[model samples]
Target chain A: MVFARARRPRALYLAYYFPPSRASGVYRARATANYLARRDWDVTVFACPMDFLDKVIGSKDEELLGTLDPRIRIERPPLNQYVWQRDARDFGPLRRTFPHTAQKGYAWTQRRLFPEHYASWSFASVRRALALHMRRRFDVVVATGNPFSSFAAAWLFRRITGVPYVLDYRDSWTLNQFTDELARPEGDPVHTWERRVTGGAAEVVFVNEAMRAWHAERHPHAADRMTVVPNAWDADLLDLPPLDLSVPAAPRPIRFTFLGTVTAVQPVEEMLSAFRMVRRHADFSDAELHIHGHLGFFKGADAALRGRLQSDADDGRDSGVRLCGPVPKTEVADVYRESDVLVFLTGGARYVTSGKIFEYMATGRPIVSVHGPGIAAEEVLDGYPLWFNANSLDPSALADTMISAAKAARDLSPEEHLSARRHADTYERDVVLAPFETRLRTLARRSS
Target chain B: MTLVDEAAKDTPGTEGTPPHVVILSYADPVPQRVLAYALYLLRRGVPVDLVTPTAPSSPTSATFPHFRVWEMKSVEERHPVKWLQYTVVHRLPSGVLNRVRRVARRVPGGGPVLRAERLARRTHRRVADLVDRRLFWPVYDHVRPLVLARASRRALASIDFDAVDRVVFTDTPAEHLAWKLAQRHPETVVDGRLDREPYAHLEQIR
Candidate 1:
């Protein structure tokens, strides 16, 4: 007898960066898409077109397209209207006369005309979401943000179709993490908009408990709806075995590899200073500080940021600090396998959590955390047997931590390494996102 | 090595080589189109080399050995105006002049000179902006090709213009360079982006 399984409820996901565009937020959106799809939720992803990502943001990783589950549906909305371009030749009449004035005009329009800055996808995204909802009646709507326009679109969908939406914060909106200030003044448009969106949302998802708690405290009325769903490492990417650290110490260079975007907030200059100190005193002269990531986010900003890193990489002449350049998502495993110690350099704080840390944890090698004290990173690296936390941002302290990490790399027992890897297995994408996925399934069913 | 690399190695870049093209791009990174076009040209027995400041971050496996990449001055070096443009693009605060003047006066024993310096900087920016708008921009546009061509001539010192059959530009900024190169070698067929797209158009599909 042939048996047919019941169809699961459908979820329409609104994400500004998805497959083809390797914006750091893409992974969170991908996780939501893949996790929901795997749990039999008929998922449709509203993603930014590849051309917009290629021409405007200038960083496109089409390889990410292959990583998506075939069961999912991806729709490209109209996002071409508000792409940022610095070329004066491409400017309008007002922009041509006063390029500086034109920039101010963009900021004004971003605040007054539409909430989405430089992202022209709001109208098109809303239009598409409405048409799709009318055609098939989406069970639940989900939107992830930092181009918080996706949330604005999701809110529009809720207003139109009454689809219970989940608001996921890949990064905080209206709350600046670096300065710990409100993104704007207390009662500005962004503040009002965020409050309205949160109050309307069925559930609000955050990357960490810190963010979730922050939002919960701010909007106590929607406290029950707020939940923390950490950005976990994709298990598929970690198919290769972690580098075995139990082998005999060799005089060869100990690769202290860091694989993530080298932004100012990550304390790259501080790390460089710490690295230079370690090289001098700790006899880590042999240790190669391999930085494998892009210099900046946009195409226009790349050269300026690269100029800073060029000095650190000693003008790409292969100093001890080497700028390895960015590697494809597929080649990430090979680089991990080659590294001896993983350097977790981040703006470590309660509000911040780098997904790279989970990927770092997956690699059983010793990790030296070169970031300020933060609960989110601390919680994740809690029981890591060979993890070294830098007590202070001081170069000397970080050097000592790096030395400790180096020592751990040389002297860890095979059992200790295996145990660390086993602990990371619990924090895999599937492991972390499963409960959140289940909650969404329940919400989708309830709405249907 | 991959098949593309193997093919590139096999292809002969002889002294008296067949007609070839050099695609010039000054500011922007290598777009996906250039990579595709280069590979297409290579496969069609046409030699193509990309002259740009930086290479594409994620090139296809096929692009490895197909075309040669010639580096140029970075955007920061080539386009110094843009460096200053981004820094002070936004409107200066209404009280900025007054605030600076006050700070200058408050500085221990160094008020007059600091205030004078601040006034000079403000005057310099205003004059520069006026000149940039009225004089430099309009004149620059008309003679852009000549300017870029002169710049390219210096940058491509090693390149043999005699052997190059075509000089192509995938974007607007480098079109002048293409035009300049085309003039020096009348025999060279220039596929200038200016002829096709005089102005940058939005990619908005109706």
Candidate 2:
């Protein structure tokens, strides 16, 4: 009897911000691709080209390129740099000849077609996927977005090739995560695309239960197909030290670290105010607030964010609020190890569950939340032994929480730290990705 | 104290010629802000040349040190069409009409007749203004970048392009001039950001 060898399921992953492009969403995209590849799936990722990462966004982490799974095939479809190009000398012939008309045409296309500056990338992504699909059929298409254009590309690929596609909401598109309202009004191009794309997707994945429920209520027909695959800390990337009771904790000048991209949406003003208030208190008088990450996603945003961090009264030295510039992923574990307490500063109240929270919890240090109450991340932090929630944005209230967190950092039992680490263990990248991988496998099998 | 005095105080002992920065600000409605940037470069020991569509209306009496203003309007007016529009169509006609009206004012029993003629001419001028704004200006503005780019070469003849280390663009209209400058002098750094400190870049080059 002759037996046929089983063919590995192929996944065409459309993630514009993938490994090497150190955008906040890139971690989740990287983890997903790596996990799928590890689980015996032939993963092919369509990501942003190098020029877009290196020149346009100007936030590339070369260290992250090495972290990607070797089995996964990566393709970077070219993007139209017309809108982002700053130098007039770099302008194309069409834009150079008729600048106003060209701008108007691009604006018109965005208004009518896909409604994103990265919309051209989506068309190119679809073309590349289709060409690849013709040579060797893909069993499934999985796409994540902020350039929610990737969802449109996945939907288009499904329409043309009849492949099952999953839409992963690493960040919300039509809904404003911060405001918890519709980002676009009714009948906007974004809303229209969201409807059509959600209607066609085989499965819709959200980072948190709040976001999942929000979309489920809006997309009732597709509710059954929706699932929550919470963002997890990369175990491969982060080497968190085990909680040790043998050595006594350091007593003075506790480090309160916030590890993530500093965006305008974050309650930075309140966080700073609380830190300043904490410094005034005798118990945490010498506490330092070290913000270790890129100041906004783009290079241009650094100066503005730096200005905000540096007040005239305090040039960061007197206040002990140090702006530690971005550290590579490999060096992140060192930042975590050196810090006594972690500051969970996020923007969105109900819907946002930051990936940094998982990494923060994994450190086994006391985690202080500096955001508004009822954040979806609180769902994960609920069982954490060392978790400290401010419960409000008022500086006084947040200051009190920071003091409590600092004390916890000094006095919390090794047992308590271990328990917190255990809570984080469930959110290790592979553990969180396992169920999602099974779902992808099932989808791929159904297509086969 | 004057900006020149401040520049002199800031850079007391510069050994050699500093980096020459040319600022192109054809569309900056406020020339004062461009002056501020020029002042910043001057204070940092860098010489600045400002190219604008028009001269600053309210410059201080105190002469600014290591600074020069090159008005492109002078070059733009040298264009045949613009020259005709300014000297012949608008200036000569209006001047001749005003002279004729002054002579008519001296004539006996010419008061009411002159008033009627003045009212008719005012109405005709209003129509002409409307035509210039509505019909002619859009096409003129569309072709203005190319014309300004051509004019910039002639306008900026005094400044040594080879010695110019930086070409700063204040706005979109200035981009045409920057683009032309970039083509001719590829080595000169062209940056749109005015907030940047020129000294930082100078340090990097050093």
Candidate 3:
């Protein structure tokens, strides 16, 4: 009797920012890639060497890297775009002639070129990936973008290979969420390119429905292809031993934790103002806002923003605010466990859903949101128990919200805490990505 | 090219009035080609006002004094959209036009009328206006004359024609504009060369 050989599903995962580099976006990309691999799909991840540069966000958990199925293949292409202090070996003559100017010039070039820098690198990376793909065909291609150039590369690859490509927009392109400026004008070259590429995509995925709707309205013809796959908390991260919730004989200072990069886009001014208001109004003189993140990545130019944040931390120390620096991914749970409240400060008013929000939810602790009202987190945290929602950036309102959340932290019952944890369980990373896996399977089957 | 280059060569700082040249282009840093010419002239103590299109991505108002950029309006004809639609929709009979032109040249009484018709067809006023409207050529037409006038007044007022010896046209677009301006006002026209085209001459001037 002749037996038929079992077929394996093939997928190419194009993520510019992937694991070992602890950028906040890496969690979702890592989880999605692993989840796809686990579901019996042969996954090939294409990323850059530049992703792991600097002490920007250090990697901690090698265990998560180990968890990736051995069947999964990883490919790294040399990225010539970004310049970092860690990359001293490659500096060569650049380090000799104009050491300080080299870094600044590199940054200036990146900003001026914007999407083109990555697009230029994509030419080489895609050529190499395509050569491999021709030998062993990929059934489907999934491209996630923050740089947006990854999507362009995938789009080009799909055009060349005739493979169905899915665009995963971690953040919206064309729409500037912070200032509401059209990122590119109608006749602009980049806008025209985006329209053409998105026009041909098999599917387009966004973090939230608002972003999905925004893209849909712009590309009405491709509206039917849009999908929403939200950022979610890792099951392993949430599976840590339950924290001992019993109040100490004498309560230590109330610790508020923010675990992400602090950049100019972040509403740092509002956060500092709220902290000051809380100190002025509330009797908790010992309260501290612990910021567990680096200031900014871009070198000398970002120094001003970094100095301002440092000064805010210094000024707040008199009133008890501390910038605890960055914690690794492995130690993030410990940071959450120690914190009395999670301070959710984010950039952009609407359509912005930060990956940290899901991790914050899994902590089952009281969260004070100091973000815009119509943000995606507002919707996610709506059903969340022990969440303090401040409608605006008003310091007075934020202070009041913080005070209430602080009080909730002090008066939390075990039963209420368990309910909060249960709510978080639904948004586990595996659970959230399960639908995505099933969708990929369907796409693979159709292609086969 | 040699004459223009020689004219642009700088002399030692001898405290003489500089020749002022106005550029009719984008209202940013004068296009690099124009800027290079301006710099060469500046080294020789010649002042310039680089008038340009008002909607420059990054205006150079503060950076360089000679880089005076601006925008203006002009009257031009407009074409019907139907003519464009016809051009795109139908393929022209390539051999018919060629054969007809040959026949017109050979025929007894057809030569002059055919040549006049051909010239008239090529220089369609409505078509030119349509092109102008679609691609914003009125901006160039209006601004070019103003730039020439301003530069001429500055040159004649401050320095001798001998001292303000050359007005180098950058390249095709600027060179073509310079050609047209030179036809109307010969006094301002200097050495003409298409060598200093900026942005690798991606920009084509009709």
Candidate 4:
């Protein structure tokens, strides 16, 4: 007599930006997928097409694709590139012949359907999921979104298949995190879509408590299932060496490093101003402020940023500022090691908790925040022994904080370093994700 | 020799080295950010050509040394109807009115003729403005992309598109030109974003 083998519980993850597409939210999606796969669940990811990654965004880190767990399956759904298509040659016959009429039709589709350019992709995702479901049933679905189309796709798939799904809010849909205002005004279809998607979700996950609270106020019915799963530093990517108890205790030029993609929203000008001001002091006379990352995510933004960084004094000959350019993900550990102090430059207040702070804290190095007061990241950095919050964006105040951070970097005690490292240890990818994974497992088992 | 050749001859160091990237800005008021990106490319040892409808008025040739600026108006000039509409329609009437004024001064008791000439010129100006607003502009708005496509094609003839590394669409209007270029050289990288990271990958592959 033959006995049927027990099947592993399956999860279908809908993420518009996944591996090889170097968008900011990919890291969280990658970690979530990898975590699920490791926990003995069969995971499949639905992501954006290669053409969108190659031609539309022109930003891809192929090295990241190699790091994905082999057990996780990835599917690319085609996006109707009517809005993003810059090359006229690729347009359809209708668009080519009657451009104005085609635009009207496209706009009508956006208004009638899911109000996003990726709405077609969401519909395509649902169709793809339904087809796959017919062959072999998926126990649960998990969708992470910036395109929020994925959330709508999951909702559609659940309605059709009666499958339970989780909504991972890597970003906000209606609330503008930067200005703390409504991203879309009243009567916008996006508000309706968000309401329906949240109302139906089996579980809703947010990156921080502030975001969770904001969404909970709007979605009180789903508030019980809503949980905060803060973004944690990936151990596999960093591969940081065991912390050394012995301090360097050497008198040398401090390397104040700011490592991340520089964007317009960040206080880059203020950071530069503070760095230059600190350089005038006797203790920081030879200190160098090294900016190591891509200038901006958007094409042509780097030029404006570079122009902004250009100094008036003899083209910054003696400014002690260095543009170290972008370091690959694999080599990021070395950058963290070489830095004496880390500059946590970011934008957004209460609702924003940047992913870089985890990596910065994990290094056990002194961190100096250059953002506005009351940033949600302060919640994580609250108890970190070496954290030096400027508390304001004023350049003079930030310069004073930088001086203190530099002193701490040079004379930090081994006990304090170990304490900071221990604080960061709690936020490790596996550590922070353990509860979320258990919840998924329980949901899958209950559904089965 | 084409305008590209003349531009290369003017810049001594860039005679043989063709532009690695072509940036198209089809809007009248080109964004300063786009110009900054072009400047950034030049600083990074990358050759650049800027094609635009209206060049910046800040002495860009002196500021952005070795940068090539190809005016889209030059292409519009090649079309006789557009030339008549742009140059002759506005200028010829004004010049004739001025000449009538000059001749009227030489004639004895020419006040009535001068008044009549002024009235005729005013009527002509009003009629010309009405025609341009109602007919010419609306037609041009629809046909501008097609005309600019030809201008971009003409501009590309000077450069080796096969060797060109990137074709960036700086704004919405430039998408038409980008589409045309993509059709001709499907293998080339035609994109909207002029990101520096992808070129690093290209360099690695090389």
Model 4 chain B weakest 10-residue run by lDDT? B1-10
- Give the alpha carbon lDDT tens digit for every residue of A30-99 in model 3: 8888888788788998875644444323333354566556777888876663333222222345432333
Q: lDDT order of candidates, best first?
A: 4, 2, 1, 3
True contacts kept of 1: 0.00
lDDT of 1 by residue, B29-122 (tens): 6777776666555554555577776766644325445456766545333554534443443225324555666777788876776767677668
Model 3 C-alpha lDDT versus the unseen true structure: 0.66
Cα error, candidate 2, residue A107 (Å): 2.8
Candidate 1 C-alpha lDDT tens digits along A188-273 = 78877888889999999998888888899999988999998888889876676755545565668778999988776677777778
Predictions: Cα RMSD each: 15.6, 6.0, 15.6, 9.1
True contacts kept of each: 0.00, 0.17, 0.00, 0.21
Cα deviation in Å at residue A2, candidate 2? 3.4
Report backbone clashes per prediction.
1, 0, 5, 1
Q: Candidate 2, after superposition: displacement of residue A21 in Å?
A: 1.2
Poorest stretch of ten by lDDT in candidate 1 chain A: A82-91
User: Per-residue error at B183 for model 4, in Å?
Assistant: 4.3
Rank order (by TM-score, best first): 2, 4, 1, 3
Best by lDDT: 4
Residue pairs in collision within model 3: B25-B52, B25-B53, B26-B52, B26-B53, B52-B69
Candidate 4 residue pairs in backbone clash: A88-B179
Q: Tens digit of lDDT per residue, candidate 2, span B61-159?
A: 145556677778778878776776556446766776787788889999888868877886787688668767886666666656677777887658888
